[model samples]
Target: MNSRKKMRGGPKKFKKLELYSRISFLYLNKAFKNPLILKVAERKHKLVFKFLEKEQADVIAKYKNLKEKKHDEVGVRYIWTLWWQGEDLAPEVVKLCLNQLKENSNGAKVVLITKDNYKDYIELPPYILEKREKGYITFQQLSDIIRFTLLEKYGGLWLDSTIYTSKPIPKEYFDYPFFSQHTKWADTCFVQHNLWHGFCIGSKKGGKLVSFAKEMFFDYWENHDVIVDYLMIDYILMIAYNHFNDIKEEIDSLPYSSERLYELVTILNNEYDEKYFNSLMEECIFSKLDWHKEYKLSIKGKETYYSHIVNLQ
Candidate 1:
């Protein structure tokens, strides 16, 4: 009987391996510039959308007549970031970014949300807490929930801990009721378009878009235990944009922003050039960087961009 069970699992394991190999190949080759990969990705994206269409319909029906509550005018006066274990346990890169955020906050209260104190800011439903306890919701996904809930309840800019700020967050970010880093469709991967960088979002208190997004997230978790897509936040945003005219208008009105959010990371290993670095900083206030990747502080006796950023006061 044991031998039979092992035999039954062999093909399933092999199939998973085959799928992972294909994914790795496509990632390494930038989708391999392959027509077949593009077609397959397009088809998959459509299917995912189709699967969620009913949920979109339900959300629209539920919120179609919704009226926002009146709140005192409070612009984005808080900057939020999360490090689940706490900042003292954060990676070196995250600490550097946190310092930069404080240095350039321009009076915005920089709040560091940690596992010990996250509940002080937002109260999530019990079901969501149960799911988290059961390991259904990850720390990263919890951060997503925290961001929307905080934005919905109180106006602020939610910055992913990985974001590096070079200057005071511009006043333009606070001008909108809802704001995100907008980019052209051509700038995205084939699987995604109509995406606003979820890593950085600026919003006003009681904004409709964020309030709806929080509802959508709650609805999703109430009915489903497993996440359907890795980029579920982006997918939720896309669904909102497609199904609601008001949400669409709000997103469409946001100016193109942070077009080069990843440019600094690309040159992190290259020899540092102060002129080029200053120009890049002048162009964009924030750059999204990854803490998971290993970067050299100095390469072969030459200082790299990563080194320069780390050394910046």
Candidate 2:
């Protein structure tokens, strides 16, 4: 069994309240299909758009004027993941995922960005650093900042540390300028607007999508001290897709992929079977696992899929 503790690095009191409130509203909206509630939600989105418009002039201009590059010119040379405490201190599940990523990196360099050496890779604005220092921004949020910034400066894939690779990353990913797992299962208030998974994003250097997201992250933090939502990274991404034509075009051009990225999580407790595991691998190369959950290494003296996957060589 993995014994390491998993830190959520959640936001502060006011931020938590805002986040939970939205979540509650989401549940209520689903439980009772009230048009009034839906109307209120639509109005809220309009307000957000109006607020974003005030800053849109510069960001939209920069996005439109940004130069585009070919895929091979800036293909996936690096695969980046972050574990603030460093790999040695990460939970066993994370360590295993890290190993799988490196083993199946397909000649790309695997970079584990730790808290101690993050500044060595990319620099952040003073306000963002200040917010992080004051605990106004969680490590999770900071990781999002780092992800977009790194993708903009150095073209590559940003896989959340929890992702386990079953095979070498498909070459088709490197063929696109910007690619994300656009699974229809992704849920959000802006579901129709955004389907991309932020956990697994690949971008070309100076890619329009990443550049626009980088701008939004910097702009939002600079203007507000408190986080408006827990999934702010996702919200900004959806906003970019809605507002920018080039980003939308790039996203729409990518084929549907990573359909079963979370399938392993649902069947972790099932007895390990090589045949079933092979079938799962056929669905997707990567499977998203959670370190926060306590998973047994064995059940009834037989290895669980969780154990088999974590211990996979």
Candidate 3:
């Protein structure tokens, strides 16, 4: 039998076509450039509206804006990640992020990944603008730029448009685990802790971890995986941790649940037996660590330098 026929034998040929069709529809509407295609594309673009309304409402209601400023003097970096439909949220996201950044006394930058008319659709603060031109770049490509810019220029915190910080994430938060010369591993290691703490999406770190994420854009050529762009930096953090044990110590020193778990597991595995480790792993699965709530509470109500600034008129 032919290769195509053999592949189709296990799963009916039409099933593959149906899957392809659904994916294509999502892409055409959500990611593609042809305005004509969006006119004929599926209803998933509605999801973008829902995401925008919910995230925007939450940000506006909770955070107050300070004076319109050209830059932050204290130099805390806030990077915003955007993919295709995410562009729809760009203006609002920038406003909200700047509000939070100003509230925290920090600088902000936006990284948009698409070949769309985001330039026309969104207006941004002077401090915030697109980092790269829209081109034939993949999710990984965009993520690399974010990491490089953060590490080299902005100091490693790419805030998503949907993510609104009520408080500041201090440098002390990253003090644990010794800093590493290896940028890739250091970033990934940090991400693993952040995700475990609920700051990111996936469980892996670095490029390898990101590689595991299923491509959402394969279905729609234009609708590349924006979600992956948000998670890519964290994914790099995981990669850094896995390859470099020294950096793990930096993450280990953090006062988060995942850090505690790491310490406990280290003791249990080292002092006890393999059986104990297995039992603990099972327990971990049943009662997964919630990093988001923990991080929120850690910085909760803490009077940041930007607190007074956020209220500025």
lDDT of 3 at 191: 25
Model 3 CA deviation exceeding 4 Å by range: 1-94, 106-136, 139-141, 154-156, 168-171, 174-236, 257-313
All candidates' lDDT scores? Answer: 0.76, 0.76, 0.33
Q: Worst ten-residue run, lDDT, model 3?
A: 289-298
Stretches of candidate 2 off by over 4 Å are 1-21, 24-47, 54-57, 64-72, 185-194
Q: For candidate 1, what is the lDDT?
A: 0.76
Cα lDDT for residue 202, candidate 2:
91
State every prediction's TM-score relative to the real structure.
Answer: 0.86, 0.83, 0.32
* Model 3, residue 59: C-alpha shift (Å): 40
Residue-wise C-alpha lDDT for candidate 2, range 50-164, written one tens digit per residue: 5455544567666765656554564448899999999999998899889999999988989999989989989999979988998978888999999999998998899999998
From the highest lDDT down, the ranking of the candidates is: 1, 2, 3
Root-mean-square deviation of each candidate, in angstroms?
6.0, 7.5, 19.2
Ranking by TM-score: 1, 2, 3
* lDDT of model number 2: 0.76
